[model samples]
Target: MAPASLLDLVAALPPSDGWGPSVATETTLDGVPYAPYSKADKLGRMADWTEGKDRERGGRQQYGNRNYRDQQVYGANQQNNPFGIIAAEEEATFSVVDNTRTTTRGRGFGRGGGTVFRGRGQRGAQNQRGGARGTFQRVGAGRGGQQQGYDNRGGRGGRGGRRFGYRDDKPQRNRDASIQVRPDWALLEEIEFTRLTKLSLDTPDGEDIDSYGFLYYYDRSYDKQPGAKTSEKRLNVLERAAYNVTTSSDPIIQDLADKDEGTIFATDTILSMLMCSPRSVYSWDLVLTKQGDRIFIDRREGSSLDMVTVNENAADAPLETSEGNKDTINSPSGLMMEATHINHLFPIQVVQESESAKRDMPNEHPFYNPAEETDPAASKAYRYRRFDLSLADSEEALHLIVRTELDAVVKNTISGEDQFLTIKALNEFDNKAQGSGGALDWRTKLASQRGAVVATEMKNNSFKLARWTTQAILAKADMMKLGFVSRVNPRSPNDHTILGVLGYKPREFAAQMNLNLANGWGIVRTIVDMVLKMDDGKFVLIKDPNKNMLRLYSVPNDTFEDEGSVMEKVEEDGDDE
Candidate 1:
C-alpha cells in the first residue's frame, strides 16, 4: 500500500462539527483491556499512543494529539485542582501517585477515586490519591520550613511592594535671569511738546506766545540707575520790565489764566515758562563750555559783533591794553576819545522778521510770492549799529543753567523718554544750598534719584513702538507704493480708471485680491495717484490673496508695439490645413 499524502489525510478528516475518530486507533494486545497504574502511567501511555499514531498517519496524528494534550493540561492547571498539579510537573517525569486511607461517613476507607500506581509492564485497577492529593505533603516547603499558603508571612522575597507617590527632586531657582531696557526717546519728545501746549494759551491778538517765552533759563538733571526715582523742578524769571508795564487785570491775562489753570504760567504769564529741552544744560558759550548750567536771558546779537575797528596805532596792541589806553590817547581831531570798542557780543540771530507777518502767509504759499520782505539797506545799517552786552561773561548767565535743567527733565518725561534718568545727572552747582536757586536744584534732584525707574519704562515703550512699526511695514510693503486703489466694481469714474489701469476685470480682481470695503477704496485711490505720475512705471502686485502669486500691469502709452513668435506659426499652419 502507498503512504498517504498530508493533503489526502487532511481531506479524510471529519468536518469541524463532526465527531470522527482519529485515523490511527489503538487496541489491546491478546484481546486484553489495557489499564494504567498511576496518573503518570496514564500520561506516559497517552504519549506513547500519540507517537505510534503519528508514525502510522505520517505525523499528522502525533501533531494533533500533542496539541490537544497541551490545551487539556493548560485548562486543568487553570482549575487549580490536585489532578491539574500532577499533570503539570511530576506526571511528565515519574509515575508517582498517592494511595492513602481516610475516615469518611464514620468508616475507614482506602483511596478509591485516586490515582492507580502502575509498575513497568504491569496493569491494574488499583486506585490511589492523584496529583497533590498523594501522600507527598512537603511539596511547597522551603529550607526554613516556610509553607506556601494564603496567610503566609515572610520577607520581601516575591514581588516588591507597589511604588507610592515617588517623584524626582530638582531645584527651583534660575541663575541666568536678566531684565531688558529699551528707550523711546522720540515718543518722549512728542509727549513733552504736547504737555507744553496744554500749559499755555493762544493770544487773541495772534501772538503764538506761550509761557515758555517768558522763561529765559531752565535747568534739570537726571540720574541713570536701575529703579531710581524721577524728580523735576523749574526756575523761571519774567522780564521784570515787561511784567510791570502790562496790567494784571487785563482780559487776555485773565483768559489765559482760566484756560491754563495749573500750568507754569497759570498764575503769572510774565514769569511762566515750560521746560521743553530734553537734556539738563543750555550753554551761552559753545566753545569753552559744551554743556553748562546757564542760558543767557535777553535779545540775541547778530552780525554787528563780527567786526571791530581800532586806530592803526592801537591795532597792534592787545584787546585789554588797547581799551585801557584809548581814553588817554588823542584822536584825529586832537580829542582823546576811545580808539575802538571791542564787540564782545555773540551773533546768535541770523534774521528777524515780525512774528505777525509770518503768521499771515499760508503754509503752502508759492516761493515766488513774498512772505515778508525788509529793505536791504535798512537791514544792513541796523546790523552795523545794533549793540549787545556780553552775557556769556556775566555772572547772571550761569543762573540760566539751573532753570534749563529743570525744564529739560519735565520735557523728557512728558515726551516718553522715561529713561532720561538713566543717562543724566544733577548739575554740580546744585549741590550747594543757596537761596531760591537751591530750592530749584532740590526739585530737580528727584529726577536723578528716580532715573532707573524712568529708564525701564522708556525702554519698554521703545520696544513696543519698534514691534508695531515693523508689523505695519510688513503689512503694507507690497501695496504701499500702489497708492489709493480699490477693488470695487465701476460705480464711479474713479472706479473705471482704476480697473482699466490694473488690466483686471472688476469681479476677477475683487475675488483674487480678497479686498475689504475699506481696503478696496484705498487700493483704488493708490492706483489713481500712480497713474497721474509722469513716469512710465508699472505696478505689480500679488493676485493670490491666499499666497504670494503676482500680477503685473504697465502704464499704457499711445506707442506700444506687439509681436508674435512660434505660437503664431502653429496657428497659421492649423488654419491652412
Candidate 2:
C-alpha cells in the first residue's frame, strides 16, 4: 500500500460531501455541533504589532489590527466546534487599562439642537478654515477657559466677529436728569416708548394762522463745492438777539387762547420734543398747565430742551463728567453747548444779511426792538400754525396751535419763487476721541461719502435730527440746509471751521429717516387726552434718566418759579455788565 502512487490513492477516495461522515442526520458530532461561520471574518495573525498605529494618527474608527478589521475576538464562538475551549467564569472580571488621551467637548444652548463637539477632529476641519463672507460662527471655549475665534470671517482672517465677552470693561452710562425731581411732585401716570410707537393718529396738514419777522436770502457761496479748500470758511462769533419763548410766555399764544383759537398751544421746539420723545435718550421735563379749556406746554428757563444734543442716540453716547469721562469738552453738556452755539451762529453766518438781499415776512418782527437792543436781530421768521387732532369719537373739535420758525429764504432757479429754508449745523468734535460714536472724519469724507456721513449722523443723533425734521415739516419749509462744522483743531473747543453745506427737501429727508408724522400726531393726541381728563393744574412730564419711559407728575403751581426768577436776575446782571 505504501508503494501505491499518490494519484491512485486519491482515485480511491470518496466524493467531497461523501468524504464527511453520514452524521449530518445527527445534530451533533461526538456531542459537539459545528459552529456557524462567515466568509468575511478576518483570520489573520494571533498578535499584531501595528494594532494601534491608526489611532496614533488621529484615526476615528479604531480597531485592534488593520488586517483583522472585522475580528472582535479570536474564534470565541464555543457552542459548536469540539476544538473550541470555554474561558472560566472568573475570566469575565479580568480587565485591561488603557492610557489613551481624549478630548471631551462641552455643549451649550444655542440654535443648534444638541451638544456640538467641534474640535481638531474630522468634524472641526471646516470651521478651522474661514467660513463664507458675512456669515457668523460662534466658537466655544477650550481647556483652561481659553476663548476661540468667533466671527463670520473666523478668527484667522478678516475682522473677527463682534465679541460678546469683556462686557464688564465697558463704561457705565448713568446720566442725571435735566431737571431735579422734587419730593413734592406727585406721581400721575407712566408710559413706555413701546406703547407710544404703536400709537397712530392721522392729522391733516397744519394751517398758518399768522406770520412774523423777516429772513435773509441764503448766501449761496456757502453752497460752493463741499469739502473744497476754497469752500472752507472760518466760523466767526456773532452777537445776535435770539429768543426761545415758551408757550405760556408768548403773548400771541395767550391771545389765541383768549379767543378760543385752539385748546392746545405750544412752540415748535417744545412740541417737536414731545412728538419725538420716543427717540430721545437724555432725560428732560416739560411743564404742562391747564387753564380752563386750554393746555399750554412750556419749558422752564434755561431748560436743556432748548439745546440741540449731539449723538444723543448713539450706542456709546458722550459721557458726562460724573461718568468717569476725562475730557471736559466731549462731555454731554459740553458737546450740547458747543452744538447749540454752532447752530445759533452757523445759520446767521450763511445768510447775506444785507438789506437788499433780506426778505420780509407778512408782518414785522414781533420780538425785535432796535431802540432798546444793542445786538443785531437774528435772521428768523415765525409762523403760527394750527392742526386738528380731534378723533371721530370726540364730541368737540380738538385743535393744537404751534409757533414754528424759518431760518432763511432761497430763490428757486426755475420757478423764480422764494423757497423757505431751515438751517441746522452738525458739529464734529475729535473723531479719534472717546464717545465720538464712530463718526467719520467729516473734514475728509463729507464730500466723497456724503450719504454715509449723513447716515452716520442720522443714526448717532436720531433724537436731535428727528426734532429738527419735525420742526421743518411743521413750518412747511421748502428745503432743509445741513452744514458740516468741524473744530478748528481736534483739541480746541472754542473755534470751528465750516467744511460744507448740503440741502434736502424737508419731507424727503423725513422719508429717508422713516419718520411718520401720523405716529407723532398720535402720541400728541394720546397725551392730550390724558391731560384733558385731569383737573385744572400744573403737570410735569419727565423722561426717565436711564430708561425709555415718560412719567407724568402733578406738581405745585410754583415748582420752577424761584429758579425762573433767579435766571431772570442773572440775565439782567449780565446785561448790565
Candidate 3:
C-alpha cells in the first residue's frame, strides 16, 4: 500500500466540527494499504505539551481548559509518541545531534528547545575544543580547566597511570600525617633546649652573630629559681587552654608586679615549657612597659634592674645621678639592649561564649570567665581560630624597625669584637644602673602610671608565640628524625632519611621569632597559638617531662579508668545505682 498525502486524506475524510484537520494514523489509500500520517503535513505542526492524548490518537477529557481564540492545550505526546509536533511554525527545531559530532552538543527539542535545523545555532560555529566560539557563545571549554593532568612535581617526565603518560602507578609523593598534631615529641625522645652561654657564647667560625643574634645567655639565679609556678587550678580539657598569657609568668614580670608600686610588666617566658631542657627554663629578661597606648619592651639584666628600688623618700634613693640615658632607663648601655614599641596583639572579641568549652562536671570553676554572645554556627566547635596573615595589620607597626632603635639594642659591636669602647660600655651597663634622669626620665614617666590591661596581655603572648614557633620548628625536625617525613620500601628505620618538610626556612622562623622585638605580636600570637593548639592537640594530659608531672590528659575513648593528672580535675560522678 502507498502512503496517502495530507491533501488526499483531507478530501476523503468526513468533516469533524470545531476541531482542526483530523487525519487517520493508519488508513489504506488503495489496495496497497498505506498510512496517511507518513506524508501528513501535520508532522511539522505544533501541539500543547499539557494535553494528554489516548494511545489510539484520540483526545483526552479536559474541563474548561479550552482557549476559544487559539486552540493551544497541553501534552500531545504523553502516550509515548516521540515525534509529536512541539512548536509553532515560527519557532525553529532543535537537533540533539549536530553535524560536527565532536563540536556542538545540540540539546533539548527542535522548537522552543529552539535549535536551528541541520543541528546548527543562529549565532556561529563552535570552537575546535567543542564549545561555542564567537561573540555569543553559549558554552565554552575555558569554563572548565584543561583536560590535562596537573603535574605539581615540576618534573618534565610523564607520571604513572594511563591518565599520566608514564607507567608507574604511584603518586609522586605522599604527605606525612600532621604528626605535630600530637605531642609526638614527648612520646619519642627527650626534647632538649640548647642552654644559653654568657657573653662568651660562640658564633659559627666564619659567620658573625647578627648584632641581634638570639642572645642565648644563661642565668644561674633565674634557672635555680623557676620564677613563679603556674597556679594549680582545675582546667577544663577542651574548654580552656593552659597558655602563658593566662597561666604562665616570668620572674621579671612577677617581681615587678609584686613590688605593688604600680609596676606592671609582661614577658614571653611561657614558651620555655616546650623549648628549655628538662622543662625548667626562663628567657633573657625581656620586659614590656605600656604607657597609655604606647608600648615599649626592653631586655634589662638582673644587676641593672636591682639598682632601681622603690624609695620611701627622694633623699633615700641609692643612685641619684641626674639627667642622661643612664640617669634615665635610656642609658647608652641600656639602649644597646633590645628596645622597641609593641602593639596590641590579641583580638579579645573573637571569644564566643557558646563555643567556649565546658566540663560535664567541674571540681573548681575559674574565678574569671568573661561572658560573651555566640552565634548559632559558632557553638558547634573551636572553629573560630584561623592562624593566617589574613587578619594581621601593617603599620609602624608590622613594618621594618627604625635604624636608630636598632643601634640602641644591637650595640654596633659585640663583646668579642676588637672595639674597646664597645666592651667597656657593655661591661659598665651589665652590673649597675647608670643613673636616673631624675623625675624627667622617659622610663620614669612611662612607669609612673598604670597602663591598659591589654598591654600586659600582648606582652605575655610574645613569649607564647616565640615559645611555640620554636617548638613547632623542632616538632617538624623531630618528626623527620623519627622517619615520619619519608617513606621507604623496607619498613626499617635505617632505610629512611630525616628530611625537613616545613614550607619555611630556618631564617624565616628566626625572623618571625624576632618579630615580637618590634611589632607583629598579634600575628605571631595567632600563628603560634594555632601551632601550640595543634602541638598539644585536642586532648589534655599536658606535662612538664623533666618534672614527670601531668597538667591535663585526654579521656581515652576505650577505657573507663580516668587519667591521673598532677592537678585536680573534674572527677567522674559517683552515683553507682
Candidate 4:
C-alpha cells in the first residue's frame, strides 16, 4: 500500500462540527499514525466545544409552549429525555461487553487440539462475542493509549517539544551617535549721549573772551582691541610734534609765518587745537521779592551803574520779561544773571591720510603729461591751481576725532574689587561716509567722564552649535565618504543626518559607559536620528541633531586603521550597512 500523507489524512478527517471520522489515525509516509486529539483539527474541535459549553451555561433560554402549564410539563419531561441520550446508550452497550471480555481469548479463533465442543450455548455465545468485538474494537483501541498518557502525565506530554538555549536572531546593537558646536564671537556695541555748548567773542585790542565749558561722557572699550599698543604710540608722537613745531622760533618757521600769516597760522593753529574743549557752565542765584510783584537786576563791568530794583503790580505786569530788557531798565550795576542749564561736549579727532603724503613724493609718480607747444609758466600755474583745488577738496573730507575719560571700579580675577582701566571716547560715529558731514558732529572740550560697559546676550546658541558641529563632521574623512547620504528628498529637506564628536576620560569612563547604556552612538541616532561620539576625555558634540545633515560615530582604539576597516566591512556587508 502507498504511504499515507499527514496533510491528506487531516483533510479527509471529520471537521470540527462533531461529525465524520476523527483527525487521529493520520500517519506519516512511514505509516506512523498521529494521535487524533493532538491534531490541529481536534484542538479546533476542543475550542469549539469549550465555547459552546460556556455559551450554554451563560446564555438565557426560552421554552416555546402554548401556555404556562405546557411550558411546565415540557421542562419536567426534559429531565428523563436529556440531550446525548443516544450517545450514552451506545457507550453503555460497548462498556458492558468490554467489561465482560476475557483477557486472553476474546476474538474469532480457530479450534485447538485440547477441546472441540459444539452446542447451542456455545454457538449462541460465539455469535454474541462476534457482534461485541466488532462494535468496540475500532473506537476503544484508538483512545486507550492516549487516555492513559493523559491521566499519568496531566496532558502535557506528547505535544511538540519546548524550545531552549540561546538565539542568534536578536537585533544587532546600534552604533550611531551625535553633538553640537557654537559660534566664535558676539558682534555688537552700544552708544551714550550728552548735551554740549560753545562760545565766541570780539574785542577792540583782540578777540579775548572768557569761555565757560560743560562736559559729557562716553565709553569705547567695546570696539578697542584688548592689547593694542600702536594707537598709544601714534598719539604720543603726534602730541610731541605739535608742541615742538608751535614753540620753535626757527627762521624757517618765522619766514613761513610772514608770507601769509593769517591763512597759514589759521590752518596750523586750528589743526593743532585739541578736538575736545569745554564750552559752557551752569550757576544759580536768589533775591528777595514782594508778593504779587516782579524784580530785576544787572551787574556790568567798567560802568558807574547804581543798584536799582523794579516792582510792578501782579495784575498789570506782563507774564514774563527778557533778561537784557530787565537789566537795562532796573538794577544794571548789581546784575544777577543766573546760569540755569549746561550741555555736554566731546572732541572731534581728525584722522589724516598717510597714503596721500606717500603718493605726493617725486619718484612715486606713475603718470606724466609732457608740455607740447604751451607756455611753461601758464602750464605750471594751471597745474599748481589744479593741485591746490584738489588738496582743498580733499581737506574738506570729513574727519571726526572723539576723546573721553573713563572712571570705574572693576573686580580683578586675582585681586577682587580693584581699579581697572576704562576707555571712553567723546562722540563715536559709524566708520562710514555720509553726505557733506559725517553722521555725528561733537564739541571740542567736555568735562564729562564715562566708564566702559560690556553687554553680551546669547542668540540661538543651540542653532549655532549645530552649525559648527555640522561643519566639523563634514570636514572628517569618514563623514565625507557618506556624502551621497546627504542628498535628501527636496520635499523633506529637514530629514537629514548630523554628526558630532564627544569625549571621555579614565575617570569618566564608568559614567560614560552608564550613559551609553541608555543612549549610545547607534541608538542615539535611532532616537534623535543623528550620529555623535565622545573623544579625548570630553563630551564634544553633545548638541548636534539631524537638521545639520551630519553625524558622528566612535571608532575602535586604533581609530585610523579601524575606521577604514570598519567602513570596508560595512560596505561588504550590505548597501545600507
Alpha-carbon deviation at 428 in model 1, angstroms = 17
Best by TM-score: 2
Lowest summed lDDT window (length 10), candidate 4: 378-387
- What is candidate 2's TM-score against the reference? 0.74
TM-score of each: 0.12, 0.74, 0.20, 0.12
For model 3, the stretches where C-alpha displacement exceeds 4 angstroms are 1-77, 80-253, 259-497, 500-577
After superposition of all CA atoms, the RMSD between model 2 and the true structure is 14.6
Residues 1-577, candidate 4: write the lDDT tens digits: 9987667777776567576655655455565443222121111121222223323333211222122222232223332433222456654344211234433222122222122222111111222222211211111223223211111111211224222222334333221221112242111111111211121111111121111111112122222322123212111111200111121222332343344221111111111111111100111111111111111111112111111111111111111123223323122112111000000000111122232221121221111223432321100000000001012224632111111111122233475533222211211111121110221111111111111110000011111122222222211101100000110222221222111111112113223212111111122112111111112211111111112121222222232225467878889899765
**Is 2 or 4 the stronger prediction by lDDT?**
2
Model 4 TM-score on a 0 to 1 scale = 0.12
Worst 10 residues of 2 by lDDT: 150-159
lDDT of 1 at 316: 21
lDDT of candidate 4?
0.20
> What is the lDDT, from 0 to 100, of the residue 497 in candidate 2?
98
Please report the candidate that would top lDDT against the real structure: 2
Model 1 score (lDDT)? 0.21
Error of 2 at 56 (Å): 5.0
